[model samples]
Target: MQTDKVLLEILNNRFSAIVNEMGYIVYRTGFTVFVKETQDYGVGLVAPTGELFAYPQEVGVANMLGMPMEDAIATIPEYRPGDVIITNDPYTTGGMCTHLPDIHLYKPFFYKGELICFLWDFIHSSDVGGLVPGSIAPSAYDIYQEGLIIPPRKLYREGKLDQELLDMILANCRIPEQNWGDLKALLAALNTGERRLTEVIERYGVETVKQGITDLLAYGEQSARAIIADIPDGTYTFSDYVEGDVTTQIPLRIKLALTVQGSDMYLDFTGTDPQIRAAFNVPTFGKTHHWLTVGLVTFLRTKNPSIPLNKGILRPVHTTVPSGTLLNPVPPASCGIRYATAIRVIDVTFGALSQAIDDVVPAAGAGQVAIVLISMPDYQSGGYKVSVLQPMQGGSGGRPVKDGIDGGDFSAGFLRNIPTEMLEADIPILVHKYMFPDDTLPAGQFRGGLGVDFRFQVFTPHCIVTARGMERHRFRPWGRKGGSAGTRALTKVNPGTEQEQNIGIIDILKLEPYDLVQIMTPCGGGYGDPLDRDPDKVLKDVEDEFITREAAESEYGVVIRNGRVDQAQTEALRHRLQTSRILKPFDYGSEREEYEWLWPPEVQD
Candidate 1:
């Protein structure tokens, strides 16, 4: 190795620090709720070839660590000193920009007329010109309907802001001023990265720092390979489903086969459904793209705590995703809800890995991250004004030794909660119920985490509500080791009222003044048998109002009186429950049991 190990470690920390500083600039200065609150943004330093060489460790969207930048960079063959490029076209950039609302911008960093690296980041704008507010609709049929597409172009040339380009971009958006504010935030982060990297170069000398980058990438590959080598070499298979997209009642399947031979792994996505007409098709370009293999990145990071966060981590990983499938769709296929598929992709990745090492993996989480947004008429500007309400996420899956998280899952766990002020800040949506549901006594010995039951009333004359990425309605998360399945998701209008109506998966619903809407996200899967759970813990749950007294007795076989335990009754009920019937290792609710009964996993394979 050209660089010493200690020096490489030092460089890794320095690069990560620069990215962290950049991330902070975005969060603090960002304009919309999704940015400052939902944290649907990312910042990092990329190699000249467009792959991330150094990224933030614990800030912003972590799954984007493997985002490919080669195609995006190649579009602009030549770059002047102080040049910055921008794009939101998922197809042209090879999925670097997964959706249109996520505007990706990058600035080239040059050292003595030599290209050192690129400072890159993206922000999910509140609205871009589209079929609805927030530039996303689960029922949208084509990419064009989702939002404005900014093909790879120079937003800044030689540090000169392209005012014309900026004007054209804002022209199509529903809320131009707010999106402009976000663009300015992205620009601020890039400037911060430039100054920081310049300081790094001054301290370490350009040649040495350059050598360190090469060595750091190599170290990342070595560390990642070591993580793979630790897992037992074998072939494992697991499959999961994405319940009914906007077009069909048929659930889309995501099948994975993990072939582990020595320090290399090959993932084959065969027997999966073809691209749908809806907005959830993943645009991975048939490669081991970021969204395709991000679950492994999570697994790898956990396995080797100090592995360098860079593109090199994917060095030992390979994939074969068939073109025109859910994972690798052709251009113009609606992909605004691709994260819905990404959530399932991550689940199936662990599903296959669990077969390899059942004891290490947790049961599945809620399996859905539904984002709620509203668009109302802007009377002042004679345009529509869009605002984010909240990102509704169910709890994480139950681990071998612990219960699932209450209201946040591992898939989108890093995102911060939307402040109450933000939810009612720009819009007239009053928060009615934004708390977790009363427990229905979850499935496992280590029970799944609870989910939210959000209800809001709109005060505007007329409004359009869009809740994309909704899932787990028909098929809830499955449990492991005799655990029961997690509860299903549901959406309602004026719930429990004379005008009550069930609106499971929505494109965009028109709401009148004083109209109420209710949404409940699915919960995480359980790890083990409910009978195996501690009785005292069940009693504690009842005391906390997490579960009803009836649920305690029926689900957990626990008898309580006057907020305390009834030992004798509990013992008899538990004994009766134990003798009832044998339970399967995986309990996939009655719905999925019926689903598999008719079609079967064998035929899907």
Candidate 2:
């Protein structure tokens, strides 16, 4: 038996509202810009079983939807009313606390001396004692290089702060004060969640709220399956890549064989390449991890926008995450840049899904997030300062009926762009051209989103810049139907000058004073054929400066004369272009096409 359908929805919204409030509290009270500006944090309510019953949907990072908390919660079996657990060790917490930079914490909620639930939260705190500034380096060879690993332990005990534990953690960070500030903000947010949840428990009665948790989870499972069952039941397979590691040209390949049978979907990654020494490992603990199942989540959410966001959504999804693969790496493997591999996993997962439901799926979005990080020495205090210069993101892929969002990628749509004034106030840099390039992919019916145009000049000497998640350079985002691929990411130093140098996908760049770096992120891939695009839409793009007049004529087969459509010329151009070549449903650009021709997916193990 279950609670009334209407009552369950009311309870769901109540729980969701609490977590969203928790997230907003953190954002308002946080000391770090990563929390205040980018909203790179997560908070949720967890049942005693450790599965998240409620998660913040409107605020914070939505990537941890399916993150398993059973292992992390089991560490400290006996928890008092005010006791809390803190961890950032991926290995120790069964990948629950993925990566060291993401400092995670959870506090038990008690009602009438009985533990009712737990409120969990995490912030992507900058500089957790790593070899690099932001504690993330794609070139990182091992976990030790990433940062300090705090196993699941008591951050607070018996309503008391563990000063020793706190000291040990803050001692290892580059910006200890800022991290402590963020920790306080998390604590404040958790308190907010506890208070809100307590009010609901008080109003609805403890038993009802407790049962509501169980009922809501089942409801979530049902809702997700309802959406997923709509997807055609079949086996679809696809593979994609992360450019390469620091030392090797062999790219990190993520493969997926998606099998949809009724309401359930099984993701088999048996043939994925072995994990590398770099920080690209996903560390999923050889199960269906949240990081691995993001593509399926996107599908469910996109297909059924009203589907509840909770652990129940994962009930209908399972995975065969083979050990030693990029998705499930062994211990000591560098997993700091695990998100890089996960994004590619999302791509392959979508790749397989597109074969099943082509019209429902959009073309690829900006498959990367290049967050500009800077670590410099403070001249006044003679201390070190680490800060995020900006999070430059690519655009989302063009959809069937709508254009992709400019400067917003599906992977990072939740995160907000940091203001130029704020970044300059903290760092010795002048941000210029922090806007969208007035151009888009000539997708068939709609244009793909225009990615960010982030350019800045560093004024402080020997300032280290680490732009992690810089991808889509070699292989661009693939277009669906007859649409063309999006543009590739480009990094140029002193453009249009004698000192111009188009430096490709960077790792950690060191700059002298007054060094200007311009990073133009890749746009999303388009859907359908360019020639099939509405001419008025093409002209609007021209008037809006989204595409050049010459490009409108050349790419979209839309010729214009004196601001009006050249009907005769347009017809002839479209005809010539249409009959020129047989269009492939997917346009993966030249690099992907050439590489696949040499090493095909069908032939691979």
Candidate 3:
């Protein structure tokens, strides 16, 4: 007989607490800045069959749901009760750890000599011995250059740490002590999950606990199906582009054609660009994978905050990924910086769904990671030191209901910029300005938020600043339903100087004493018609220096006189704009026309 619904939900809620408690122990005992402050980690409980049973909803990384443990478990059949398996291989882990920087650990939970569940955890280590200190670079061409890829092995056997394996890992990375601290903390976190999970089994009986996993997964499946069933059944296609290849100026195209029939959805990625030589390939293994649906997942997680975390939540969705494309690349394709392409995947998905849900979808966003890497050479140390100088990002696209968040990281939500003080203390860099751009927001009924304009000057003579995945230079973030496109991003060296350079995309330059690096991050696109916007809001933008008076007159059809909007002139201008008989659709720019041609239905498949 099945248990009561209330009891099942209560146990599920308690199971969530157990995982959260597990995540906290890692943060409390971990030693690295990544785990302690930045908190780039995750924890969860797995059924004996390797399906996810319980996950931390509020905390922990949300993207680890696709990780596969059955293969790893098969690779090592014999395991004691306290034995723990460790791996960082992207292919071996079944896309669990997307890259080598994220080290994954799993411990078997046994009840009377039979394995009942698996306690799983992962943390992005500070460094693994590679061409770069952080084990990630746009320049790296393959997985080999990224770092060491550990196969599934016992990190701990019978509750005792494997000294040889630990030594091998510590010796390969630059920060041994910090890595060890993080590893120990992970083990401790798993132990917490183990203790609480065993207690659950003891109280409810193993059979009931096993049945709870099935109940929770089925609940999530029902919720997801209900959401998809509301959308009209039809085929919708959309496409977007990455800024460019790191080694080339040609923009990489990513296409998506979504078909929603009944409660099922399918995403086809046949016309996407061939994989590049650089590090921008997604390693999803081509399921309704996490990389392809992070935006929708975030939306669902936010809306249904209490939904259970399991594979069934994603059962309503499926994907068709072509080999050698940016979404699913063949071997030797560098994948260290795959998140750049991941952003385009999300944007394309939204583009496909716009036809079905105009109000639910907004416009395009700054679809690139504003990554900046800085390195300093110390003569006394005799080696180069590296640090991420503000993992900065721009705003998201404005929604139909409201404006996007200003100076926000889109896909990697909850990840923040490293503090200026931390950068100054750890690395040799001076931060002069870190604030929102003065007049970067796009104009509409709902204006897109502005991006951060960070100014930094190098103090060290032998320092270098390199960056990748910047967009909105040649093409702007496009708006929808008569809204205006957002302003483009700019990267320049020493404004007003005759020798200043306007860098478009992907550059590695040496820094001098007086050299400055200024990044004007991209703004999000607006929603609805600008002519329909409030006159007072347009006046405020002009007065507050968010947009120029000329911009209001030209784009929004609102006239300003003596620091205020002229009501009579604005009314006349709005009328003129409405009757202008413009031939251009709202998405009129390089971003739309190019992708439209590249991903036509005939060319697909």
Candidate 4:
């Protein structure tokens, strides 16, 4: 029996590899830049119980894993040999779609009439039919403006494409051709899942294959439990805020409380803010859903990349995101930019977990960074051209073990900025400057990483630039323990010039020729005491141009004279600075944080 269990675990990992390969195929073959470059998609193999048994490592959006495949299966009961169910519905599919832009598809696999598994994939389509080009707006207030809400329906009936549904979807979006290409790519990925699954069943009998899933989840549960157990069991709570709902101009709060007992951990989110009418609400259907857990999973991945991606990882943990809250919004509550709040939730979770397991968790990171879309009519092509003038992101705060990585990737691990050459080729724009912003990173023993700065000149006569979910502007990512706070975000036109205006939380910007657009991202928070930093490291940073001599004297109390460290002067300054500085907990966005005014941290705890 034990041998069978071990074999099942091994087979589970093998099948997981197959799904990962399938994910890569979808990414490589997809047409959209969002799919090809940013990799904003997910691939999973659902078990007989309708839960995901295997998910992709490269794919980072893990919250949608529990989205009920059973509801989708029942919606199209006429499941023949080859049929795929596709939908992006928030209500009918049980919060699977959450918003209209994401296109989701699933197909069941069978062996001798016995249903074995379901293949699932979803991608954030560039555009969907709506009042706005992106298929989301805070002002819209209703589902009608949010674009097409696809309920669970058969996209392929008996291996043949459903032409009517395809036509309807294509007619609604601005980029139909590109969307169709992505759909075909996803279909190919699902085919890969089917092929790989067939081999698993053949190699280790169908019964064993099913049992392997259960055992793998068990193993993950054990591993996650062990990780949780190491932290001294206690209840730690924290809360954070987003700028506001674009429509109401009211700030939103996300609350969390972490409870640990032995190997079991529970995340309670009870005092969170009420769900807004805006598109920023999180649609996590309660439980230890992916939105709140993926960051922890990302951190866990750094330690154990071999752990299986199954519901079992959630076994040692649980969540309580309330309905109509920021973490769990209701229908027609615009969730188009929901990931913004999700990133903060991840940050707060780390904040709370840091209390129990300081070494395992990391300091605050640049929350969520985004590039706005600017569009205009191209005279040469007589077509609308889109421009991503700048790819924005915040610096990663220094970790307990090491210095933070500069200009790090967002929540989606695979997200990478498009090269200047590619951006220029795709749009009518000239790249002026793209480099790390100086004097922005927080300084400490292990200095925080610096954020990016990008400046562009619009060549077009008229262009529309829209930005949403740009946080860390009013407040910065806070460090933990003795670390320091990070720098805030900023955006403007010719920042140092006379026309400079603080363009914060922009809905849209109309641009004219020779308009210089500048975006400065948030810097990472510094960890540990600055005085403890090695003088050699500070000198090196000065040489690397990551830090300035003025910063070394002011922030680190390190005095440098004639390009050399003045040991006696530095020692006296460090001693005085260390004694004078107050040893207080790092301030995240708390001064801007409203506790009872919105949601309580324990609400989601």
Q: Which lDDT tens digits does candidate 2 get at residues 316-411? A: 888898888788889899988777778888888878999998877788888888777888888887778889877778988888888878889888
Please give, for residues 1-605, the per-residue lDDT of candidate 4 as tens digits. Answer: 33375686678778779878888888898877767766767888887666677876655354554454555565665666698988988667665566777899888898888877788888877777776666655456667677888888888987999999999988887778888998998999999888888887888788888777777767777777777777787899887778746666666767788898898888898888888776687777785666778667765665576766777777777778778787877666777777788888888888887777677666677786665677788577665564344446777878877788888843543566777887788777888888997756687677777888888888678777766567777767887667777888887986788888777676657777888988887877777878888898898888788888998888788898998999999999988887887754665645454433354444534
In lDDT terms, how accurate is model 2? 0.86
Each prediction's Cα lDDT score?
Answer: 0.86, 0.86, 0.76, 0.75
Candidate 1 runs further than 4 Å off: 566-575
Question: Number of the top candidate by lDDT?
Answer: 1
TM-score of 2: 0.97
Q: What would the per-residue lDDT of candidate 1 be over residues 400-508, giving only the tens digit for each residue?
A: 8888898988888887779787678767678898898886547678888888889999888779999878889999788887777888999999998899999997778
C-alpha TM-scores of all predictions: 0.97, 0.97, 0.92, 0.93
lDDT for model 4, please.
0.75
RMSD of each: 1.5, 1.5, 2.7, 2.9
Q: Candidate 2, clashing residue pairs?
A: 365-397, 439-546, 483-528
Ranked by TM-score, the better of candidates 2 and 4 is 2
Model 4 alpha-carbon drift over 4 Å, by segment: 1-6, 59-74, 378-383, 386-391, 589-605
Ten-residue segment with the worst summed lDDT in candidate 4? 595-604
| Candidate with the larger lDDT of 1 and 3 | 1
The TM-score measured for candidate 3 stands at 0.92
